[model samples]
Target: MKKFLVPLCLFLASMAYSQDDLLNSLDSTQVDGKTPVTAFKALQIVTLQSTKMAAKKEFYFVVSHRFGTVKDGFDSFFGLDNATTKLGGIYGVTDWLSVSLSRHTLNKMYETGLKYRLARQDDHFPVDIVGYSVADINSFLEKDQYPGLEFKHRLTYVQQLLISRKFTEKLSFELVPSFIHKNLYNPDIERDNQFSFGGGGRYKITKRLSVNLEYMHNFDKPDFYKNPLSVGLDIETGGHVFQLIFTNSQAMNESGYVTNAAGDWGKGDFFFGFNLYRVF
Candidate 1:
């Protein structure tokens, strides 16, 4: 028994010495500018869903220029010829929740909104549904005209339902149901403040390139000038997205396009617009 114990103790000591020597050799090699073989490497594993998650916070600013019919010839003098700029930012509070604020330079239209994902598409469910709301403030008009004004006047409210579905790997479409409520309008102009429906579609041509088409129709205004329709192409590169579009609608804001679009597509009055997006 004593002889066997002695041999086992010697073997254990030899193994410990071998490990210590190997560790010391590795340290010396690192210090001497030599690469050492490693049994395992530090690695990061990311799942497809985790890698594809949207950014936590995103900021976007776009300058949109519209060139078409001018309501009055004076517009040409001011270079208001047909130009509007919009600055917007989106903040993702959580993985599935986000909020956005935007201001249109045209007529000082300010909008704040929130978005939440209700359902995500998976192998069992083929559709992705998101809920969104936007509150628009139109600060162009005056409210103290009436002799007996009772309540403080505020701008109109526009609500929209954004529905998106992925039909294929490269194609997706969205349908929007919008409602607009306004208390007053210009006496000379005829407009309706009612619920409306709009729809849009997107087709992905490549990984970072796609085409979008959107149309909005006013159910209350059957005799209104015309519905608004826009078609555009988007190019996404790194942190910038450039959009070039052609549309018959001349209005810059949501309410303007939904209620006061006066341009005609058949008469060759459609205008070309460009949107440049930058992030810092």
Candidate 2:
């Protein structure tokens, strides 16, 4: 309870000061482009999923690694000594649709999801819209720990709309409206069905390198968990996109990061992570 006191105070203070809602601030800003633009090269911009998808008949293998908190300094090898990894594969069913399955070391979690395009940023559409649905199962729990635990208690689901635009060749921005549901949860700490809004962007610095930044704010998330913030550099090589990231969220999947982010950016409590994707 003592440990949570500080975060609760901070959360209350933030809410009082945050008069402007994040999602409402982003009114439709049209870019000066006549042709359809390729907004980003990768499927995700740091923590926010981008509108990019694999080509039809193409498949992508993903490797994601998140280290422990860097606050422990050299004693923990700057977080390298304790790390969690996620390995997943994504396959394109069609040009506009894709499916994914992955497992993460954290919570012994398994995740599966799909991404489908609803609209493209072109002559007719002002923004690119993609729909994403995901499911998560926590395999780390045991019947011995909780005598009454059930299988449904370990499940979570998420749905999101990824809206993005390529304002210019060097710049692109995205907004994500997310809905998350947990089968079992503590009513006082957090709600069963959670809602969060996220947005991010990529700016091309040079030919093959870009800077990415994103932030997620949960309207219903508890104060013990801080909102997730991520910044990274995307290196676009010929075969893959390598993302070097620093984030306050240790969880790689949507459900974990959205609801259970456990790091505090104010104290340098963050994780060093990377997302690597190889297309075949």
Candidate 3:
């Protein structure tokens, strides 16, 4: 009986030690705390950038299309016959930093930009802050398009501060204060610098679907241009986010859409558009 009791005692002591070690390992992991809230689900809330970012080392491919104005009616297949498209790619350098390059069929514009997250929403923070800077070059612009146009005249720069709040699991909103600089324009008629403000929001209707709305108001809009207002539906599928949109803007890039929009929503000049985003 003494021999059996001694072996059992040793086995029980080993088991107790193993359990203590497991508890200590779990405690160490718990010290890292809970993960924070993810800001936006998609990279874009319509044409406006959202607070979402790609994970480190991840890549995203986006395709966007905008049809002509609805004012054309059936004559243009509700504007589908005059579609302008954009192709873009984005890469994450770090969880907080990303860069993208895109080409818009409208104006044959090419754009490159960087976005950085200054702050993220968490239990301690109420909002997500992001900075955006982009340069757009109108490669399609020619001397005939604008008399005496030089190569430098094709360049436009934009800067924006994006602030977003996730009020609840199903609601999110954002505001943008943006500045635009044009390298060359008709100085007699237009200013080289302009200011615009944008607002957007999203509401979830289902686990995989949501409604989105965005509008941009230019402070000193050109008489020929119109403010842009867009409404859309976001559908989330496996590794893809598809958006069906309608907007009073035909231009897709920040500079073009904000400053050169020609469609007037009051006149039923809105266009139908869609965007497809894929992650890899």
- Cand. 3 TM to true fold: 0.85
Q: Highest lDDT: give the candidate number.
A: 2
Q: Write the per-residue lDDT of candidate 3 for residues 166-259, one digit (tens) a residue.
A: 8887899999999999998777666899999987999989876899999989987768888888899987654356789988888889888788
Ten contiguous residues with the weakest lDDT in model 2? 20-29
Model 3 segments beyond 4 Å from truth? 1-34, 144-148
lDDT of 3: 0.81
Residue-level lDDT of model 2, residues 132-208, one tens digit each, is 99989999989998689998998999999999998987899999999999997888788889999988999999876
Provide the TM-score for each candidate, comma-separated. Answer: 0.67, 0.86, 0.85
TM-score of candidate 1 relative to the true fold: 0.67
Task: List the lowest-lDDT window of 10 residues for candidate 3.
Answer: 22-31
In terms of TM-score, which candidate is strongest?
2
Better of 1 and 2 by lDDT: 2
Clashes of 2: 0
User: Over the stretch 13-65, how does candidate 1's per-residue lDDT look in tens digits?
Assistant: 44333322222232123412433221100000000000111235644333455
